[model samples]
Target: MSSATVTTHTDDWVRHLLFDRGFLASMKGESIKVYLTMLTACGGEPDRSVTISLRSIQDATNLSCPTVIDSLNRLEELGLVVPTMRKSGRVKTYYIPGVPPEN
Candidate 1:
């Protein structure tokens, strides 16, 4: 058996941001889903980042691989999320520009 202490603050602003088209908001279906999912995976900080896997995302949102990738790419282009490689060089660390990263 395995357990994880997930410290994500994903839903705090959902209600407020439901119609907020200025805060990295996306009008596209897949893009919105991806953005919401990323928020859900972030730490409780207002603009925190988290480590998300493609497989986990696919399971959580039921989005296809291509769609997920495309959505992430779109988000990146929009400067909403910043992706950096960890020391392991495998998993990526995604940071939201609105929040300062942990030191």
Candidate 2:
């Protein structure tokens, strides 16, 4: 008997926090976009540190830089996203907690 090994790719999967009542009730659409961009916009990797760029977030959410900043501030204020000192070159990153898969 011969058995073939299978390797499944997880690079296409991303994780994010659930939009529960309290979270949804509190966050605006812009803020939500920011949340989602952080969640799935980055390359689906296992790293807890999300190394996404502002341009990437803006492109994913179709929001202006100022709007994205506003949303990030709101998310940070509400403890949805935590900015870390970690930086990939000049880009900033966030440390996600218990983030789930998005696809």
Candidate 3:
């Protein structure tokens, strides 16, 4: 017989997103995909912030530009993701909820 071990980090927000019936049920598939992609990009940083371009998100999720934009909007509306910075020609910074912004 063989045994396998698994390690996991405690991310209550992720748990809520995955197991909370009301919240999980309210999310669209594309929105979930985008959120997960952003989480991967952030990699559990303390601030949970990621500066990524729309093209990068599209490439990561294999979603169209418009679709990615819509998903971002949905995430923002749901208070799951917040845009920390936006510039005319620069990648936007998004912060996942549950972390206080550094001052």
Candidate 4:
């Protein structure tokens, strides 16, 4: 077998859910990238309340801390990822649950 990691074929799915369904297409470029990256990282778990750390996302995406934080904030503003307060003395955690329909 090949030593490469078998990534999930999620591009079409993301396109369908975010674009074809008219959710994220209206978002900016950075916002779209971060949102799609989070969705891809989240996998098939249906728990919308699932939480993750910025460091984890930065490591996964190979992005800097500030970049990850900025993108995450944009997603939050767009009603994509939900932010939660972590008990780590004001450190925050974010959950990339799917967004609601953009009425």
Candidate 5:
């Protein structure tokens, strides 16, 4: 039998969330899922933000609307995700922090 190799790169923000903040041990699985989905959307960059809809998140995570909302709220409470409302006041952009820029 042949085994497939799995390769992955760990970003600073991911490390911060998992190790520094100990979120993997403290946070709910749904919250972690939502946080990761947002990070993937933004390419895990603190400088870049993702403008995504709640429906999209629900679709991606296969989570209910209420569950997704609750997860987002939890992430916000932990200061892991920052959300800003657009001028339209209808759309929100999410920013993931904790990753410092490279020198």
Candidate 6:
């Protein structure tokens, strides 16, 4: 038995749950990009908080701050993301709840 086997065969059931809840429907281009970025931070703990700054998302998505802000607002309106105060006393932090990996 190898450690890699356990890792590779890990049963990630989050995808099925996301599908049941309609998160897959929102997986489009930019939306999917941002959602994946946040979900990656979840590290299989989908229920945990996935916080990322606007600048980080902007860099990853190659989108301007305003564009990212608009997209985030849209996601917030859809109840996918919630805005929260940052612990570092800097810009606002975004919390992506139960974010699903891109399709």
lDDT by residue (tens digit), candidate 6, 1-103: 6555443311355555446667668555676677666666656554556657778888888987877777777677766767776667435666655544445
Q: What is candidate 4's TM-score against the reference?
A: 0.61
Quote each prediction's TM-score. Answer: 0.65, 0.65, 0.78, 0.61, 0.75, 0.62
Cα RMSDs, all models: 8.9, 7.4, 4.5, 5.6, 4.6, 5.4
| Residue 52's lDDT in candidate 6 | 71
In model 3, pairs of residues that clash are none
lDDT, ranked from best to worst:
3, 5, 1, 2, 6, 4
lDDT of each: 0.68, 0.68, 0.78, 0.64, 0.78, 0.64
Tens digits of lDDT, candidate 5, 1-103: 9999764555655776577657677679999899889888987666567898888899899999899989999988777788876535335788777653332
The alpha-carbon deviation from the true structure for residue 83 of candidate 2, after best TM-score superposition, in angstroms, is 0.6
Instruction: Identify the superior model by TM-score, candidate 2 or candidate 4.
Output: 2
| Best TM-score among the predictions, by candidate number | 3
Could you give candidate 3's per-residue lDDT for residues 47-90 as a string of tens digits?
A: 57889999899989999989999999998877778999986774
Worst 10 residues of 5 by lDDT: 94-103
Clashes of each: 0, 2, 0, 0, 0, 0
Put down candidate 2 lDDT per residue, 34-92, tens digits, no spaces: 87677664443344668677888888899998998889889887766778875666468
Task: Estimate, for each residue in 1-103, the C-alpha lDDT of model 1 and write its tens digit.
Answer: 8998764344435443444535444447888888777877874344676887887778888999898888888888776678875536336678865532222
- Residue 14 CA displacement from its true place in model 3, Å: 1.0
